[model samples]
Target: MNKIKAYGTESHKDDLKEMTIERRDVLENDVKIDILYCGVCHSDIHAAKNDWGNSKYPLVPGHEIVGKVVEVGSAVKDYKEGDIVGVGCMVDSCQECQPCENDLEQFCEKGMVGTYNGKNKHTGKQTFGGYSTTVTVREEFVLKVPTNLDTKAVAPLLCAGITTYSPLNHWNVKKGDKVGVVGLGGLGHMGIKFAHAMGAETIMITTSPDKAKDAKRLGADDVIISKNEDEMKKHKNSFDFILNTVPVKHDINPYLNLLKIDATMCMVGAIEPLEPMNGGNLIMGRKRVAGSLIGGIKETQEMLDFCGEHNITSDIEMIDMQDINTAFERVTDSDVKYRFVIDMDSLK
Candidate 1:
C-alpha cells in the first residue's frame, strides 16, 4: 500500500482535515493518477455528511476528477505516464451485465462501484474519491481528457458536464430545437451551454429574474422568469426539450404544461421522492418526463469529445481544500456562481 495525502472527514459531523489514506499499488490494467483539480459536486456534500442515509464514514467525497496519469500497469495499452485523464462518479461495475454490455454501466445490475463511499467489487473495501492526492482505477474506467480545454475548468466535465450532455445527446437535440433548461446553477449552466452549442434556441427558465443577464452570458438566447405568470404563459406548449436540473421539489406541472406536443423533458436532478403528478398533463400533450444519471464510460468519453469540439466547460469558482465546509454551506444556500472546484494542490 502507498500512503497519499488527502483531506476528508473521519466522521459525519467532522470537518475535512489533513489525513493520509492508503492506495493500492498499481495492478494489471490499473492506472495511477496524480489528481490536480476535483469539482465540488452537490452530491459530494450529501455523501460527506451522510444526508443520503447510505453514506459511509471516513468518506472522501469527490467525483469530478481531472488529473495526470503518473503510472500505468504493464497491461495498460493506451495510456502512458503524464497523460491527462479523468474519473467520474463510477469506478467499476460488473462487465457481464446487459447494461454494461450495452455500454450503460451506470445502470449495472450488480451495482456500479461509485468513486466514493462505495464498496470495491473485488475486495469489498470502501473506495475513496478524488479529494485525495492520488487514485488507482482500472484503465477502462478512466477517461481521456481533452488536450486543449482549460484543465481546471474541465474538472466539472466529468460529472456536471456529462450529466447534462447525455440527455441532450440521447434526445437528438438539433438545430432549431426549442430547448428549456430549468435552474441556473452548476448542472443547469452546463445544460444551457450544451443546448446552445447544439444549435438549439436555448431558453433558461428560472424563478428569479435576477439570473436573466447571467443566463444570457452562459449562452441562453432567452431567459424566462418562471415565477411571472405572464412570462410563463408566453412559453406555454413551446419547448421542444427541457433539461430539469433543480434538486428541490417544486410544481413541475408548469414546466410540463409548457412542453410542445411530443416533446420530451429529461431530469438530471431531484433525487427525492416527488409528489404525484397529474396524468392529464402527460396524456393531453403526450409529453414525456424522463430521468438520466451520469453517462456510462463510453458515453462519458463521447461527451468529453463533444465538449472538446465545442469548447464547452463549466463556469467554476476555484477554492482551496480548507474552504470545502464553507463552500458546502454556500452551495446549500445557492450562493455560488455555477460550480466550485477544489485545487488538489491546496490539499498538499
Candidate 2:
C-alpha cells in the first residue's frame, strides 16, 4: 500500500478535511494514475452525507476523475506511463456475470464496485476515490482521456457525459428528431450537447428563465420555460424523446404530457421518491418512462473517443481542494453554472 494525500469527510456532520489514505500498490493488472482534476458530482455530496443510506465514513467522494498514468503494472498491455487517462463511477465488478459478459457491467448481477464508499472485491476493504493525489485501478477500468480536450472540462465526462450519452445512443436519437432535455444542470447540459451533436432539433426545458441564454450557448436550438402553460402546450405530443435530468422531487406529469404517442422519456436524475402521476398520463399517449445510469467501461471509452472527435466537453469551474465545502454548498443550491472540478495539485 502507498499513502496519498486526500480530502474527505470523517462523519455525517463534519466538513471535508485533509487526510492520508492508503492506495493499493500497482499489481500486475493495475494502472496507477496521478489525479489532475476530479469533477464534483451530486452523488458525491449525497454519498458523503449518507443521503443514500449506504455511505462509509471518511468518504473521499469523487468519481469523474481525469489524470495521467504515472505507472503501469507489468501485465498491463493497454496502458503505459505518461498516458492521459480517467476513472469513472465503477472500479470493478464480477466479470463472470451475464451483464458483464454483455458489456453492461453497470448492471452486474453481483454488485459492481463503486469508485468510493464501496467494497473492494479483491481486498474486501472500503474503496476511496479521486479526491486524492493518486489512484491505482485495474487496467480494464482505466479509460483513455482525449488529449485534445481540456483536462478540467473532460473530468465531468466520466460520469455526466456517459450518463447522458448512453440513453441518447440507446434510443437512437438522430437527425431531424425533436429532443427535449429537462433541467439544465450537469447531466442536462451534456444531454443537450449530445442531442444537438446527433443532429436532433434539441430543446432545453427548464423552469428557470435565466437559463435560456446558457442553454442556447450549450447547443440547445431552443429553450422552453416549462412553467409556462402556453410554451408547454406548443410542444405537446411533438418530442421524439425527452431526457429528464432534474434531480429534485416534482410533478412529472407535465413532462409526460409533452410526449408524442409511443414516445419515450428517460430519467437520469430524481433518485428520491417523486410525487405520483396519473396513469392516464401514460395510457392515453403510450408514453414510456425509463431510467439510466452511466455507461459501461467500453461505452465510456467510446464516449471519450466521440467527445474527442466532436470537441465536446463540459462547462466547468475549477476549484482547489480547500474550497470543497463551499463547492458542496454551491452545488446543493444549484448555484454552479454547470460542474466543479478540483485541481489535485492543491492536495500535493
Candidate 3:
C-alpha cells in the first residue's frame, strides 16, 4: 500500500480538505500515474454531498483525470513511463462478461467498478479518485491521451466528451444529418462539437435566448428557443436526430415533435424520471426516445482519437485544488462557461 495526499469530504456535512489515501501497490498488470489535471464534474459534487444517497465517506471526488505515467508493472504493455495518459469513470470491470467481450465494459454483467466511491475488488476498500497525488490502475482502463490537445482541457474529455460522443457515434450520426443538442452546458457543448465535426447541421435548443450567441460560437449552426411556439413549430418533424443534454426534468414533448418520422431523440442527461410525455407524440410519428451512459473503454479511445483529428477539447476554467469547494458551488449554480479543471500541481 502507498499512502498519498488527496482532497476529499469526510462526510456529507463537511467540505473537501486535505487528507491521506491508500493506493494499491502496482500489480503485474498495473500502471501508476502522477496526477496532473482532474476535471471537476457535477456528479463529483453530488457524490461528496451524498445527493444521491449513496456516497461513501472520505470520498475523493474526481474521475475526469489526466496525468503522466511514472511507473509500469512488469507485465504492463502498450504504455511506458513518461507517457501522457488518462483514467476515466471506470477502473475495472469483469472482463469475462458478455459486455466486456464486446468491448462494452461499461455495462459489465458483474457491475463495472467506478473510478471513485466504489468497492475495490482487490482490497475491499472504497476506491478513491484523481484528487490524489497518484493513482495506480490496470493498463486496460488507462487511456492514451492526445498530446496535440491542450493537456489541461483534455481532462473533461474523459467524461463529458465520452458521454456525448458515445451516443452520436453509436447512432451513426454523420454527414447530412440534422442534429439538435438540447441545453448549453458541459455535455451540450461537446454534443455540438461532435455533431458539427460529424458534418451534421447542429442546432442548439434552449429555453434562454441569451445562450444563442455563445451557442453559435461553440459550433452550433443554429439556435432554437424552445419557449417560442413559432420557433419550435418551424423545425417540426424535420430533425434526423436530437441529442438531449438537459440534466433536469422538463417537458420533453416539444422536442419529440421536432423529430422526423422514425427519427430518434437520445437523452444523455436527466437520469431521473422526466415530465410525463403525451403518448400521442410518439404514437403518431413513431418517434423514439433513448438514453446512453458513458461509452465503453474502446469507444472512449475512439472519441479521443476523433477529437485529436478534429482538434476538439472542452472550454474549461482552471481552478486550484483548494478551491474545489467553491468550484463545486459554482457548478451547482451553473456559473461556469463549461467545465472546471483542477491544476493538481497546487495540491502537490
lDDT of 2 by residue, 157-249 (tens): 999999999999989999989999999999999999999999999999999999999999999999999999999999999999999999989
Residue range 253-302, candidate 1, lDDT tens digits: 88998899999888899988766788899998899999999989999999
TM-score of each: 0.98, 0.99, 0.99
Q: Give the lowest summed-lDDT range of ten residues in model 1.
A: 119-128
Output the number of the lDDT-best candidate.
3
- Per-model RMSD to reference: 1.0, 0.8, 0.7
List clashing residue pairs in candidate 1: none
Task: Report the number of clashing residue pairs per model.
Answer: 0, 0, 0
Candidate 3 per-residue lDDT, tens place, 25-51, comes to: 999999999999999988898899998
Which scores higher on lDDT, 1 or 2?
Answer: 2
